[model samples]
Target chain A: MKKDIAKLLQRKKKQIIDLWMKNQLADASLREDLMSNEELLEQSDELVNALLSKLTDDNLSNAESTDFDDVYEILSGISISRARQGFSPRETGVYIFSLKDALQEIVQQELRNDPVTLYEVSIKISKLIDSFGVVTFETFIKGREEVILRQTDEIAEISTPVIRVWDGIVALPIIGTLDSARTQVVMESLLQEIVDTGSGIAILDISGVPAVDSLVAQHLIKTVSATRLMGAECIISGIRPEIAQTVVHLGIDLSNIVTKSTLASALKHAFTLLQLEVRRKQKETSTLKSNI
Target chain B: MGHFLLVTIQVDLYDRLALNLEADLVQMVSKTGARGVLIDISAVSIVDSFMGRIIGNIANMTKIMDAETVVVGMQPAVAITLIELGLPLTGVHTALNVEKGMELLRKKILVDGEADNSDDEDQPGDGAE
Candidate 1:
């Protein structure tokens, strides 16, 4: 009976070894599967199970400590190549996440050369995610607050900047800081508003501005140039004293543009330039004559 | 420095209210000397360009008064419509609620006061305000 028990134990050990080898083969196949089809990357559970089952006494003893950085380097190369092949941003995020997960598992299993190597892999993965253009309102804000915040920003930034007047007079009141990106957005929105409204006069009020940089000044000049091309008069208003000093010091020229110190002054100037005053007088005269 | 103006509009007379709000706001600012005015839109749901134009007018009027006017508490759908219609509120301040509007107005008042004080010191004979 003792001899029989010993033979059974030996058979069980051999079977376990064979099973481990089979699992290793399966893990290798799954890795190839993930690489070929991006969708398989989300199947993390199956991949993790396959990797765990592959460990055996002999293989574990012989396994060299893996460097997660090496794996990340390989993954980064593959991701860039895929991106060059026209992979979408979402696909790139998925692919990067998969590689990060695998590397994390290896580190957690204590198979990595240094535990700190995991942090390096994580940083690379984050950089890759940023490169994927992962900016959206939903990602930044949660629930109904997202909608409200976005609406508020839109109203403050886009809607409040451009005002449409009767007879094609568009006024934009600028406040706060004008970074490069925001400047671009403001330019595009104003141009589109002018086109849609067919405004003959575009007034930009910078009264609320505290300062102006070279880049912002450049954007303003560009906006004026474009508006002139469309046969529209661009009026700038609210030139604060400090901003004026900066513009002069920076050698930015505003020779061709019309400027005013206030929105009321700008509108009055715009009305005169657009020849709307004569029309207003004619209407008033007609009304007076009819009343008489 | 923060003042609230509640202008009630009957459902059918909303259009008239939009056309008249700017003139009314100008008169109010002249009377109150408040730094900010908040127009509550919690009662009205739909707003057209006429209303938007009036809001713009109020914004411009406030600048003349050396004050700021913010349209507050507009329904979400109305806000969306205003955006889609390309209604211009240039020079107009907007806020999600009355409290926020007050906060913005107070900040504007403080900043303007500081600027005026500095301008006074810079140009002694000239009236900066």
Candidate 2:
């Protein structure tokens, strides 16, 4: 009469924790690499205790009930941590669902004398645990998404590097497909380097670009024009043969841009523009050569 | 007219100021019989299509008056902005600094002086690209 399920679960917290831990350990997906046995015990014990304290017959069917806030918090914490620890979906799913199995096993034994009450309570608890499993999955995916977002940010930062290849020339070799945002970064950094180094020539080697569409061409043009605006000539080098075919096929006008077939040629052009010659130093024919 | 008119535009120019300068420059070139015009715009920061047109007009007008015109000391930012604005500055010659501008003008005058006794009519101007 006085919230019998919550009171019973609270009284037998130790029994539930033992059974839940046994169920997890006996399962084949138990990953000792991700979490140690002692850590798993502590986490399982804490979650089971929080859930039992918050459990009530009224809130059994409603996992989102305010009274279950502490339970939800503990559940989400475990879920996100497992996600970061590289647990598979099935491993994590088994973790939350196994707790339900242990609880149901205890519920069946505790309510064996009254089948009707047992059936209703079992249904309610099943729904509640199922919803908690869903919340676990949601938080797990959110955690994974955060990791992916961080990786994307790192890629964007590292992909656009402007290198000073010569005393008065800079080269930017793009290794990925160019989007508008990336193109903007390339242009800003190139222009900044031009101003800093007083470089008159900037070489953009886009041989790594996979395809040549109109949009990619437009971004390239914008970057080139931006470089030129700095009163520096921009030479686009490393135009692959297929990319050249696509450019002509698309009728994209790169007439104003100076394109080279390789980075070496672009460097040579930069040297010519800067009036720099890479001369080979003659070896001193030593009088000591006779001693040798 | 005596040697060459050196106009150093130190501030951002408006339409009226630019047009007035162009008109005065043409008249001065003819009145003084100057051989070249050097407009130092390294400090003038802003340029729109209208300003680009005015600069082009000055170059063309001076050329018609038998004087070569050179734009010198254009800042990187200004050049970038002008290029983005679709003005490639094809009509007039551009130099990195004042010294280069003077050398360009001197070479032009030398070519003209040797090629003809009197400077002939100007060729049609190439518009902003």
Candidate 3:
């Protein structure tokens, strides 16, 4: 009976030590001290909670411990190293920020750092950040364009590679290469503006576009579909001869969207199709009656 | 002052107006001692995420300025576009149209003003209406 009681106490001490280690508290020495003291064991839960709360509070306050200057110094060092290896500052900045965040997190966990694991993490971080950096740069460039386009409501003229005239009644004018992103932007802006302006006809002039790929052609078709849904018409204008040949070679059908040679011709056709002459006559008659 | 500021964007297209059109409108409302703002965007044809975020940021900043902000004129397509873009215009208030937005602003203003005025009134013994 005495031997059994002693074994039971030993097991309880082991159990408490295991729990403490799992909770990321003070290591073997502290765990041993905790297990030996009956009074400390009694207050184990309270002590654990207090330690965790303190750590969290310290983390929150210490987050801003690294000043902007420190960050900038680290960034500059990374940039110089990257330049030596033939990478841009924009790319280097991304790689460094990502690595810094991961390194900080790992250090915070107070884990024993394996050199091999550190190397792997650094390589992964570098590649991921580089890719992200390239994408970020591209997005920034696109953002500048968006700003320009968004501000350019007063543009009197635009040119593109291909223009489509819909129903011989509207001229659809497109400019620049039509990527999926730009296509969506253009489509929504054009359709809403067309509706708001109450234009009887629209001219989609695309004389300024340098090229049209398969994705772009599909985007054009989708734009046409969206426009029809909104009770407006779309016309593709400025179909360069080479682009026409490519369209045929690629077997991409432009059947749904109307096509035109030039914006001027499309506008003329649109006017005739809408029978705008009648409206003009009606306006004249109303004015004459009012005068009388 | 009430929490909401009401401003009408009379232009048919917001892009055609000044780049700081929304900011200017908010400034006007601030001058009027409004604690909140409601912007009428029904007349706008296109609303990009950048513009949406600006409105949201304005709302957040307005809080610091002792005001709140709301955005109205969210067409179905526009709303969907904004969502698809993953831009959150959370803090701003949105209404169906300008009139509705104005009504909300007016109600808030009246309630706040009445509360303040009653607090200042010394005639506690006056008969209830």
RMSD of candidates 1 onward, in order: 21.3, 7.6, 25.2
Tens digit of per-residue lDDT, candidate 1, span A36-108: 4333332333333332344332322222324223333334444544444444445544533443344334333
Among the numbered candidates, top DockQ falls to 2
Range of the 10 consecutive residues with the lowest summed lDDT in candidate 1 chain A? A132-141
User: CA lDDT of A111 in candidate 1?
Assistant: 24
Write one digit per residue (lDDT tens) for candidate 2, span B1-129: 137778999898877888899889898888888877888887887878888888889999888878888887766667657766778777777765566566667767766755674443253212211
Which tens-of-lDDT digit does each residue in A1-292 have in candidate 3?
2122223323344343445434333322233432344533434334223322332212222323332233333334333433444444444343334333533344323323455544544454344335434543454455445556765533323422122233324344566677766666666666555544444345667677787778878777766655543334567778888888888899999986778877766676666667644358788999999999
Q: Rank by DockQ, descending?
A: 2, 3, 1
Local distance difference test values of all predictions, in order:
0.56, 0.82, 0.52
Predicted candidate 2 versus true structure: per-residue lDDT over A217-275, tens digit per residue: 98888888766544577899999999999999999999988889999999998888777
Error of 3 at A239 (Å): 0.9
What is chain B's TM-score across the candidates, in the order shown? 0.77, 0.85, 0.64
Looking at model 2, residue B110 earns an lDDT score of: 63
Could you tell which candidate, 2 or 3, scores higher by TM-score?
2
* Candidate 3 per-residue C-alpha lDDT over B17-97 given as tens digits, one digit per residue, 9 for 90 to 100: 544765676576568766657776666656686666566667776767756565665553665466456553655555445
Evaluated with TM-score, which candidate comes out highest?
2
| TM-score of structure candidate 3 | 0.34
